[model samples]
Target: MPLTGLLFAGLAHADIAPTESDWGGTGLLQTPSAQMAQEGELGIEVTHVSPYTRYNFTLQPLPWLEGIFRYTDIDNRAYGPAVLSGDQTYKDKSIDIKVRVWRESHYLPDVAIGIRDVGGTGLFSSEYVVGSKRFGPIEASLGMAWGYMGSRGDIDNPLSIFSSRFNTRPLCGDAVGGQFCSDDYFRGPAALFGGFSYQTPWDPLTLKIEYEGNNYQHEPLGEKLKQDTPVNVGAVFRLNRNVDFSVGFERGNTAMLGITLHTNIAQATPPPKLLDPPPPPRPTTPPQQPPEQVNWADVSRELQNNAGLKVSKIARSGSELIVTGEQTKYLYIAQGIGRAARVLDNHVGPGIDWYTVESTNESLPVVDTSINRHIFDDLLDHQIDLDDFQRSVEQDAPQPRQEEVLYQATPKAFDGGLSLTYAQSMGGPNAFILYQIAANYDAEYHFAPDLWWSGTVSANLVNNYDKFTYTAPSDLPRVRTDIRQYLTSSDITMPNFQLTTAHQLADGLYGMAYAGMLESMFGGVGGETLYRPFGERWALGADINWVKQRGFDQGFTFRDYHIVTGQATLYVDTGVQDVTVAVSAGRYLAGDWGGTIDISREFRNGVRMGAYATLTNVDGRQYGEGSFDKGIYISIPFDLMLPESTVERAGFLWEPLVRDGGARLQKRYSLYTLTDDLDSDNFDDNLQKITY
Candidate 1:
């Protein structure tokens, strides 16, 4: 059985019903309620409401907070027909945040405050506080909304009692809309909105009715939309646990339809189907007294074939046998240990009283796990249970004392493979979809334990880059916006080629140095150092780089652009919901001084999703389209999709718009990531899944 199967051995499997929600929101039609998705849940929604269509991606990064990214298209507005060919619509990108103030109780309702379109063109911006309560099979919600939601002026601004400035909202400032217009926030007239949802006897059906606050008078693109009535009705049909379908009659005139696909990233670990068989059972009884000579070669082969370990060296210190090796297969470190223990029992004699397994990654030591030979022997013999065996094991830093060297396996030098690669860009004025599919050849040559040379060559097989014509407007150096030129200029390209060396300088201190073609756009030299204590919640690091832009063909040729850039970074593992915050500040590729803040949540299955925003000295208008650089990315471990265990991962990043403002060097490696095994708590968590 796989490690995940062993961890969740007896859990029952059954159909899980989908939760009720609006188009892309967790509430009734047209208005938000206090409901929230389960923690670690990710949802993608596509909603169409006549003149406007919204694409939403939502994440419950924390129990008390929900983050949303949306791209809305105005069906009635065109993106300058004279400047572009074919039919194109004007699209706006926005971000939203909602925070739960209080949870629901028997007598109290769940309360939440939310801001919509915080830093976008003030087209659909709104702020509101809402509450929801459940009674029997029905749930009720109510709220007061301001800004676009209250544009009908249904009632006088009650907040004006405190200040006359709250009576009217100021006109939106600039066309480039990255600035947060706090002056207009919650200042205009307010209106009341409420809704109710009913769970029907049919398990998959949910009905909703809402009285919306917005009258649809102030629509995007200076078009006045008519609202026949304030009441809206909708229904959600649960197609399955991961999908939902919804349709509604909104504004008593327009028909709305949407679909949502959701999944719990933390619990999506599938059992491994392709794995090595369990280790051979322990000897039925103690072997004679001791073995005069053991076949160490056969023992090493067994450990490698069955335990997923590549032994570097094996030696004896006092009465304990130490095996130093790297794990290449098992996802859980303990599983590897469990299997290695059995291999030791069969090969070594009773003279070896203890077994010390030192695990490493790329030849760098990670942990030293010591096991009681007798305890493990008893468990394998069915005389004791696994829980008791686990209680007898100890783990700490490796203390390797040279005594008698038994064996040292040959190290692998060169490894390479070919794989399919896809690159895409969307939601820009030039083209709705621009993509390239290619065959990528990746190879790595290991020089020593912690040093290697790696590179990737991509050959385009299919693409539509000819349609990419829009030259993004930017006042600063074109560090990234000239992506179209790069894509169209090369049918065969080299994206990365670098020589990297990583080492442990001292306890809890790690360092990395690299040079060559760092990325497709730039090539240079850089180094990074990080100080992260074992089992600690925080870490600090810094990096500096001097790079020059590579030619459009992604070849050895260099461009005129060159700059020195770097950042001092801080990382904190916030105890809430496996969240991590990374902040970096320094100089950017465009010679601008700025900082970036990134917050991400790691699921139990190694799925990481996060958002980041970069701010620089460049003005919003000068930076062009997005005002600033911002994007959301998800890193998925290949093991989640493959039947076999792997250390590979794939990353997908979505940026609303690409610009030149806050471009950072795309370094291939970082010290913080290289030293991840220093986290002892993570090792312990994976150890708990061990089963022999």
Candidate 2:
């Protein structure tokens, strides 16, 4: 499984929910409905799951009752011409919604009643469970569920075997020659299963064991094969406030391997003191007299009266104009191209200027040699199919997921290189422009095909470093060898420069592009090597992007390597809060190629704070060796308090997928807090009102 899902495993209260719902989340733990209410009485739980990855978010909505939502899906799929021919494949999604009826505390047994697979293709089944009892160091629980089930045991296609080359027709083999195959692969009705779990009373460790199976409603389909008698066993260990681990295994017609994880949500593992809500908005007084009328012509003419300032109107629509102005302290606008927002804080200057420049005309660099020049004017857009990618990985085998890192910084040659250019109007429409010097170095590291996260991708321009590290049983592969060999032998270099442009094409629609090139490196068991062309190392593909805003502040982009990524958001005005929802699909065109989707929303009150859920789909290797690993993850930023001195945070990033996969998440989660450049000694003086 992808290591991302391991990010959420245990519960702070026990509502059986992960806490948040994110687009690219993965499920590494089970938060069953009945179990959620037992953990807490007044909490809410949100369960987010994908084809191969499942995520559960349970909370106490009340003190005595708990609400729960569980989402999980597995699209039965098969690849390779041979396997694909012998079986029928279809996408499947399972959703379970319920309200726990009770929890056995000191004297009584726990109970609950609710719907299972509620908003899904009903297997025509629901479950009722109860539990409470301790046998010395062992704790146990029992539960039963009844529902509609499907079984297709008698259907047999000839592709089942060790090699794809084998072709044995019924007439050519004993089993086939007998023509005994029956069309019974899909058949089943109501069934039963007893669920139970146990743990040591003295330690944080836990153990679980359970079996679920059923008898057919008609008769034996094929040769009276065993039913759904699946069994599972797992345990967890809380290493510290910042670290924890878990492992579990299940077997039957299908099997699963999993782990648990918990990390910082806020600066403290135990939440910080919630501050009292701010005072309500005060009533505004009506102006005693009408505002003084000022001559628009006089204001426009004043540009020339200012020190070395020049102003000219290039275009005009109605009340707005394409005005150009320049002075000793600032540069002029591009006619009607961009706009100017005011920030006249005395600490910085008289005011700040914002606008946009023509990127194609500004001489942008190429990063990936594989890509021709970025089609600057190419309007064709693409999107990542996260849902499809997740389904594909679940049916296939495991492959290496590509990871990269890079850095960049530009001098203050152009008003801190900030501009606000509006390409068009929507006020009619508010225009937007691309600003800020875009630069960064990219490093791509490969990991061993297992459940742990480890690798290194460093970008020199932005001073950003991404590291993925973890360990698993021998059954899983380790990435240490691959990373070492690549670093030692690869011809890839750092500081691959790139320039990005954020453009507003229309209302609720914006586009951005990043183009650059760098040296390409290849890695293997012994080491890595750079593929060269003529005597020069070949450059990687050009990194170009175009985004289409889906709403007031959300959009999706396509990188063109068979992947689609997008962002979603929810906004609230009480605190002027903003939440971001993001998703990524498809692999980097290498390794066990697949896609990942993540959904996260950010909340802010001047600073930044929020929780998110992420789901990732990779190939699985156990059932289908070489299968893509599937993963789910949930993470929250503990540090929203900005540093006092920092004019702008350079390399600091919280949007993990927006950063470089899991690298930024790991680093930000480690830091206690970031400080600013504002000196406390002068803080008091700056706060006093200024008089002319």
Candidate 3:
């Protein structure tokens, strides 16, 4: 999936100022530069230059890395025959990346290396190494390139000096397209490109000029144009910190216009929660009053209202008050526990020395969090700080609390959400994009904490998927390619219907089972289990499901196709660069034996971007277009966009070509997500928020 392009990041470490280029990266009008946006910086850009209209979504997931996904519409070219392509213009999809090699300094310029077209049709394939130096308000960049970027043949092959293999540049972009084209990298006549941008006296305007690398003779799909000049000029107007508009003239013939919407995700935060109840302020000094009379019923109400916990019971174990409940609102377990501690402090006896929260989900034990009352009080009284308090906090596996019962809670048996979802498939033979919009109704009934029934009913609002007429030929089972049929099946569809049960099998061990309609296309039974030591960086999980294909109409019916599928997965959270990796191997939906590796970066603010690829036993040709299953995905916290805080996220996954060979089930739930407290990051991150 890294080859596909991820779409999230935070800040940049480059000293060179970033400018959105025609090709989507940080650069001048027609060529890239050594500049890089901040990590977690994300941008959506649209550029038009003569015969090309390009839409680019670029991301800086790390300070030193940038990735782009671009779609280009070429003029005067049809995708194919009118009947098959519906008069659609030629559309090209490509991925690109840039990485910071060195940060600029007073004595030296910033440097970078990059690829223009990675694993798509090699229409704009090129590689370069560039450097940018700043002088007062002027910034200049110079770079050498190969492939399309070096079409001018301004110089002989520089890399050929090292090996004769680099003397010849091979033609790329296979008939099927989407090839890696690695052998063509930096092998050919090279070109020199340089540019300079000047910040004008006018605050909002900047001017730039760059030398052309390509002569316009070697073009995509054999299209050709005459180069009137080697120099291009552009001017950019910044409307605000997040928006920019630019216009330019390149090749002395073509006019260029573009707009970019950019923002940093890691630094972004939700607006103030003016609508919710505010937490009680910490006291400037510890209370010296006598033990106060307490009402257990009122304590339960306070915990539910202020802590977002659906309390099961509250008990006392000597000097400790233990509360067993499920967090129903807060995104982090520490948030819920911290809030509960505040309510307990006011309601319990003054002698209580410890506050413990035994968190649960669907009645299954999660983890235990205990905070020393003296340390908490000391912090509240300004006698200690967060650092001193953390030493007294303990998080571990659920523990037995044979204590005195005080308060009990009634069950709020059902909860769900109503959401609108927009689904899309892009770059099809018949159409550039096919999209569907639907309204979903989710419902769940709790039989008890350990068992429940949950399902989703989605009603189609509208769709433009009628043009989904082409299906790539696959030698394996058609487990996933039939998405078109499923999408068009009915006005109302029940994609999921299941009864599930889960319980804690042991310390660091959990188990779950479910049966019924498991997903839109499959139904039957499945089970999963996970072993995650509290506070550890690694976890092991496995899931197995036996399912039958569903009918196209999505009715209460099934097709004859059936198979057993499963996977054994290991997840590791590498503290370096806030990255996490997941490795899974087992049976795939198409009866293929394969494995998948997923890599992602997560920020403390709840924004995550990742890519994954799966390889199966089948040969590349047998697996159909694009070879195998691979995609990029991003998950953003809904709190960032909503008026009020919510423990929900918006997610999007981009799959270039969805095939069957390495397909995996889109599970309704996972232990990794259900019990996210298996790791200590959240606890450490949210510790200071307790008093707030």
Candidate 4:
């Protein structure tokens, strides 16, 4: 769909200039001034968009262009998922490059174009564009792009939901043949969309209208498909500088009202003169005798007379009071002020450097008092929700709020998962959907022997149907869905019906094992029991399993398999000042599955390296020359260096890129790799990889 205004709202903010921003992980040269790079101010803006917080980073790259990077995390919204019965999450990390093609200074409206990257399935790298321009009183914008819409689906077949014509069978053949037949397209097929909008300048109002359409020419479903369209119209107003209101309607289905603010960092500073030079070494006057009853009035008046003191009337019901303000000239002044207020300065003024020990200790007593009065209430009120503050640290680092101390915890673990899945037609020519979700979670668990465990769950489901589609010819009554436009009448076929399920399980030596319905399907059971033996880094594990395949499935043969797997793991810990690393390795053996080796290493900075490879051959399979899919996938997530202001002292800009969990400064990065192992007939089988 059109991505207008989605990048930058039409506000009287400084124009975003394009400057080279350092995206830590990737290598790129920094662009300097004079190259039309970003200039002026740099900052982050965050707004609570209901369930999802809108984190927007704005940069004035130039007078005509604005760089806006915004992402929405729906994880904070609902508690669970739809369609799938587990937790579901949707995250949009969009990078919009906006350029102002035309601008008439402060009076003229500016026009800009933006390109956004939308993640999608193979064959189509979803992308869109928006163009906005101003013409005197009527400021309007138009947007258009060619790409599919919606989040990437975790479907067995990528094409099952999107354009099917873009779907091609997975490459199947001998190594050489597979190389030549493999599908080259990984992004989804392209779709087209367009939209436009209009708005006004002062009443500070904005109104816009737009439309979008997608063309499915080569329809991925192997058919000719019609296009789809959606429209939207909306307006936004500035209630004042800090507050804004917006309302919009989309395709007659979605309506929205949004209120937002741009909070300016408040800065309280001492006058430049007092801060630069000492107060003429406070005239060497004879030490005044300490007052007896404290003539508070005359003392207050004299204190007000002190050049460094500021006096203000503090009306009180019982007394006409005066407040004496002492500005701490520096870190040193804080100490002197504290000492002076308690002694020589008390009589001259109701001297109270509340900001020192008193102010800080004041809040402590409030907490202490509440805790003394009602410990449980205090505990509940001050309950440490680490997750809440961790999320807060991620959003606004420099200006972290009260609970930001949670960021000081060390990142103790790194976990990741890789899955290999294959599905095809089986018994009676019916298609089957079979896949396994294998994941690993390993982190330092103990002191001497680091405990770690890895497991995989294999599942296969087969459905027999008369036809894949019902819209086939009358003769093909077996087909359940429409496939008319998907293929030539002669090329269509019927669906076959079959039922199947695969069983998978896992358990610890003392932990409980509950197989439930899984034990009934596979006619066999499989799981592991593990224990930490001598050291925290060492674990002895064993797996017992029985597997049997029977019945008449064409490409499949009935077979029975059994095996006891034994595995021993070792972990070594290395500490370097603040950086720590733990390396672990384990080996397991089974019948046809042979012997598998797993090695993982975690760096203190959040980098993780893991590799799994199988070596032994069984079940009439060749020893070291079988065909198995082995590949390495690496993921490096370094700290996203976002400049922020400290929340406690919001005015001071601090380097919050590298966080120490509230301790010493720390930086984080990660790396991952997956490789294929030889001698495996399953090209997609990751266990056959040599290195990962």
Instruction: Please tell me which predicted candidate would have the highest lDDT against the true structure.
Output: 3
Regions more than 4 Å wrong, model 4: 1-65, 73-89, 99-113, 118-130, 148-204, 213-229, 263-692
In model 3, state the lDDT of residue 336: 73
Q: In terms of lDDT, which candidate is stronger, 2 or 4?
A: 4
Clashing pairs for model 3 are 9-39, 9-40, 9-41, 10-39, 10-40, 11-38, 11-39, 12-38, 12-39
lDDT of 4 by residue, 1-692 (tens): 00111113223434322212111000011001111222322334443323334444443423444444444434443322343212334333333344656654556434444333211112222333333333544533343333333212222334436656444334222321101122423333333333333335455675655543333343222333333325546565656444445565543554545444332111111112322222222224523432234454454344333322222211111111222233221122222222223233333223221211111110010000001112221222456442332222110001111221111112234334443332222111111111122222222222111122222233232222333322312221111112222122322111111211111112212121212112211223344444422113233444343333222221123334322322333323222221122222222222233344444333222222333333333211122111221211111121101121111110111111111011110001000100000101111121111111
The local lDDT score (0 to 100) that residue 59 gets in candidate 4 is 39
**Model 4 Cα shift for residue 180 (angstroms):** 26
Which candidate achieves the best TM-score against the true structure? 3
Query: What lDDT does model 2 reach?
Result: 0.25
Off by over 4 Å in 1: 1-23, 82-85, 272-292, 376-393
> How many residue-pair clashes does candidate 2 contain?
117
Ranking 3 against 4 by TM-score, winner = 3
**Model 3 Cα displacement at 6 (Å)?**
18
Error of 2 at 389 (Å): 56
lDDT of 3 by residue, 1-692 (tens): 11112222222323323678998878998788888887887788999987899999888888888899888999679988898897799988888989999999998988999998787778889998899998988999999988888899879987887999898898874465566778988888999999999999996899999996899998987888878998999999987666789999999988999998777776666556676567744544544432334576777778888888878987778888788887776765666777787776655546788888888777877888899987887787789888998888987788775787776677768988898988888888878878888999999998987899999999999888777877667788889888878887688999999999988888888899999998999998999999887778899999999999998877679999999999999999997878999999999999999899999998777788888888889766787667667788888877666555567777878888878888888889898888876667766866776775
C-alpha lDDT of all candidate models, in order: 0.80, 0.25, 0.82, 0.27
> What C-alpha RMSD separates each model from the true structure?
3.6, 22.0, 3.6, 24.1
